[model samples]
Every structure is written in C-alpha cells, then in structure tokens.
Target: MYRLLIVDDEDIITDGLYEVFNRYQPERLDVCKAYSAKEALDWMSRTRIDIVLTDIAMPGMSGLELSEEIQKYWPRCRVVFLTGHSEFEYAYRAIQMTN
Candidate 1:
C-alpha cells in the first residue's frame, strides 16, 4: 500500500483531501493528514511515509525546508508541493535543488 501524508495549515484542505482520497482509495493507499510542517515532521519521525504532499507557504517551516529534511532522512520518499502561482519561483528553485 502507498502511504501518503498530506500537510497543510488549513484544516479544511486537509480534511477535504482525506475525504477525497478515502472516497477513491485505489491501489490500497493509506492517507494521513497534518496541519503544519511541525506536525507532519513529528508524524513522519515515527511512521514510514512513502509520499509527502505539502503546501509551500506554511506558517513556520516552508514546504521546501520540509522536503529537504525528508530527502536527507528518507532519500527514497517522494515529496510533492502544493503552491500558488505567486510561489512558482520558489517551487522551481526547490525542484532544481532536488535534481
């Protein structure tokens, strides 16, 4: 099963994502939700997360920082960012850094 962690500061977005994933749970995927980067990190430290879907403009630690940390610890983990059009440059830089 593919384990997915969805991180966003907004509860509604996380809840909506969980609901959507739960509705169409193909490939036996498991979804977990976190409201902030800190929360996501805490959960990840104890669990084996296959994929991290995070927002770029979070309050404390940005998704870029989280993605870097995840790569350092879990090199094989996939990190996907959710960003606004204004944050395209940041996302581009992050993608470039990873490559």
Candidate 2:
C-alpha cells in the first residue's frame, strides 16, 4: 500500500484529492490529510509517509519550506505540489531540488 500525505489549507482540495487517489491508484494507497504545513510535519514525525501532495501557499510555512524540510527528514519521500499559482517557476525550482 502506498502511504500518501496531502497538505493544503483548502479543505476541499485535500478532501477531493484523497477521494480521487483512493479511487484511481492501483496500489492500496493509505491517504492522510493535513490542513496546514505545520500539521503535515507533525504527522510526518509519527507516520511513514510515501508521498506528499501540497499547496504552495500555506499559513505558517510555504510548500517550498515544507518540501525542503521533508528532504532533510525523509529523503525518500516524494513531493508533488498542488498549487493554484499559474507560475511554473516555483515548480521548476522544486523539481530541480528534488532531482
């Protein structure tokens, strides 16, 4: 089963994605939701998260900071940004860092 973590301030976005991922993914994906970056980090310390789907604009910490922190704590955990921002610049930078 693929353990998934989704972080977004918007409840609807995270909730919708959780349903979609659970319905479509071939693996028995276990999904976790965090309303903010802080909550996501807290959950990470406790559970084994395989992937993180996050919104770039968060209350306390932006997705970029959370991604960096995840790299430091769990290098193997993959990050997929889900942002409303039209600019791809942030995504490019994040992708480069991930690689």
* Model 2 weakest 10-residue run by lDDT: 18-27
Worst 10 contiguous positions by lDDT, candidate 1: 82-91
Q: How far off is residue 9 in model 2, in Å? A: 0.4
lDDT of 1 by residue, 1-99 (tens): 989999999888889988898677666898999999999999899999999999888899988889989989899899988876585688687789578
lDDT of 1 at 5: 95
Can you write out model 2's per-residue Cα lDDT over 2-42, one digit (the tens) per residue? Answer: 89998999989989987888777646888888999999999
Each model's total of backbone clashes? 0, 0
How many pairs of residues collide in model 2?
0
- At residue 67, give the lDDT of candidate 2: 95
Off by over 4 Å in 1: none
